[model samples]
Target: MTGNHWGYGKDDGPTIWHKNFPVAEGTRQSPIDIDPHQASHDPNLGPIVLNYDHCTSINISNNGHSVVVEFDDSDDRSVIQGGPLDNPYRLKQFHFHWGGKGCHGSEHTVEGQSYASELHLVHWNAVKYKSFGEAASSPDGLAVLGIFLDTGDDHRWLHMITDALYMVKFKSSVTDFKRFNPKCLLPSSLHYWTYPGSLTTPPLHESVTWIVLKEPITVSEKQLGKFRMLLFTGEEEDQRMRMENNFRPPQPLKGRKVRSSN
Candidate 1:
């Protein structure tokens, strides 16, 4: 379960993750199915605000699990506040979880319905926590904005990321991806469903305050196909595994009330 041994394969997938990361079965685990009807509407919940105009995107890389775009979080240049957050959380990185050809792969679902993919923009509590690693372990230390991706017409700004996917196709590969602001990837509406949940991947720490957008961004099948081309294995590895279906299924809600922004 250590050092890239865990994967989407039958033997090493989410079903077996609990053997290593015991918290995988924790009460507040994430990627839960969001039942809109059951979610309580909070009248006092303010609209979530994102200030990413000055975000310094550093690089894009393949980390054997998913493709991640890392940002320079040394300062509070870019952060997310309002909504359920008490303070502005510093933006750390963004990544995607997707399925194979012609399959739905989103982590969190709406009323049991699945989307083609999910995008996670991760942030940390810089005011209270000294480092991202420290923030990731404490409850209420992280905030992750989840956006669903539906297949249809092409997404105008998504091409900026997809165009560079070829450069980091293999695991551990990284390339310079500067000056690319993720604000362009957002939908017009900021309406979201908020909850207290954990990370969807390994070390599934229950620290994140999840804000999942109600609106889904559209991208063409051709664009999604580009992500499928990425390999989970490194270039030197003889057995090349296609990086697809890289999503953990929805976890139990555990009686936690999901709140919706008005």
Candidate 2:
């Protein structure tokens, strides 16, 4: 009903991204399929071993279709070994990529296929943004650490995310459970897909330096339904099914490159 927290199938479908938020067009996006022809063999990048400690209570917000997480003070120590030592990027926000009950939801398909959902650990170059949105225009402003999702039996895996789904449904709604860390959500292996791409959502800002994990974490069907519950109610009056297909349409390949850590 309001300007924010749009699930899927509404007037502002994921495809009409650029039209909804004029500023979104200015920010880098994700969930793009990689073109093998353009995918380069960059020596500087490989599987990034992330060493994050502060979780800051994995808070989520429904920015129309997908949810975005805001990390309190998360950083990246997984930069390419010989690359920049002090990672100027600070974990700013995060979100997910999901499919229906029984399918893939990954953004970058492996040889043309999607996963059930992908978890994006979005960060901003502190060297750029005094505030999160400040660096929306800078090409090197964002660094997104992506992890894949699969079905699993451990309920602990959903602890940080599923618990806080209700608070951030709409704009200006904040949820803080307690002090937490980000390292717990990750697995032992850090293999991933790296690339330079635009935002998967509208406005399509091309400022993100992405690192997508090769391995995926699994969740039970009941778990994903909880995420759907995040947007079940709208504006205190419009209580429609708010979680219908909140995925963004794939973007034009437009001459970019993708890298991998496998």
Candidate 3:
């Protein structure tokens, strides 16, 4: 089904996703609650290596669901390796999911506690797969780095994004956003939880090897408020629905093991 057909509404929410994408009912579904005490500590799991020093960040856009910042992945200039991956995965794009003010908007939870929002840095296994679309459906195709966002003082560089929200208030709107390396957005620590999970959005492909960070980044409440200003509908559409609470609730663990890095 098309993205427009599925949304965070009463009639089109996660509860009914199984009807459209059968994989929604899969055993390895994503956004699962992370219980730190239950997770196994693997000494073999090395620290994840991110080589984004010279990464080429392109433009940012609003895709009706969330605001996405695209990157140029033509070469191996921007790639992630080590940890749970056998080969380096090329960085594709990054996006955020959030809720209305004063509510949790994160897709995944820690000990059943949800953060204000979540950040997903999507990458594809360019070595094993030729294209991102091809990799997105395979078992070992993608790696998503999830970072939690909490309400606090304004982030130092987040204004570079929130300031540009006015340009892409409507769906499918995009603008130039050059040289913005996402490495600046990462938390101080790279210690994370790793697992095999599906895409939080539809098709709900079980192709992602999730690496969720333990620490959360702080962003002011005013910055998050800017996200709510985006409209889910096009400018021509008569109905205006503000975009908020765009995250999917955590799914069942289904006996999948969560590995932690040292």
Candidate 4:
């Protein structure tokens, strides 16, 4: 798994990830199935607040794993607070996971039902840690907001990112993508399910305080197809691999209690 050798293929997929990153089988691994009926509703939980009014988005890139839109988190310009968080977490980057044609590919499922795609807004606890890398390894150092994307009418704001997919179709490609605010990607309701979990990808660090929104945002198949056009292979590679079904299946709950926002 060193030097980005891992992928969603038969030989090197999620199942075999633990061989390299043993934390993959950790107790708090993410992308767990969220059972609404089993989740306890917490009236004490406050509304999740996102302050992206002055957010500075720098660029977008294909990092071999997913298309990531990075931000300049040097200051507290854009951050998420309230809800299950004790302090405002600085927005670092956001990426997505999706399925192939006519397939559901969300990471975290609802009552075992999967969505077409899932969006992750990664934030670091700048108040406690000095850097994003430090925050990622420590427990309670990160907060990832998960938003499910269902198939339907086109999302007007999503085109901003999808339109740029062609520029970074190959892995390790990057291009200028400034002033794009992710606030537009949020659903109508901030009501969500909260739990302690790890990253869905490798190095499955169990440091994230997960906040998954209840309502799903709708995006047309046409828009989602734009994501599929992206290639997991680099431009130099002879083998062409379409980036689809990049999501990890739901992991075992392992007695973890999911809490619902009031």
The TM-scores, one per candidate, come to 0.97, 0.77, 0.97, 0.97
Off by over 4 Å in 4: 1-4, 236-240
Please tell me which predicted candidate would have the highest lDDT against the true structure. 1
| 88: Cα error in model 1, Å | 0.3
Using TM-score as the yardstick, the better of models 2 and 4 is 4
Per-candidate local distance difference test: 0.94, 0.60, 0.93, 0.93
Q: Write the per-residue lDDT of candidate 3 for residues 1-262, one digit (tens) a residue.
A: 2654898889888899899899898999999999999999999999999999995999999988899999998889999999999999999999999998688899999999999999999999999999999999999999999999999999998999999999998988999999988998999999999999999999899999999999999999999999988988776534347889999999999999999999
For model 1, give the 10-residue run with minimal summed lDDT.
Answer: 1-10
Q: Which has the higher lDDT value, candidate number 1 or candidate number 3?
A: 1
Candidate 1: misplaced stretches above 4 Å? 1-4, 236-240
Prediction 4 global C-alpha lDDT:
0.93
lDDT of 2 by residue, 1-262 (tens): 2345333465656655556665444423466775555566666664454545444544556655566665665334322221221355666666786765565556666556666677777667666467656655567767777776677675575766676776666534666645555566776677666766655654456777777666767677777766666553346535465453556645545455666554
In model 3, which residue pairs have backbone atoms overlapping below 3 Å?
none
Clashes of 1: 0
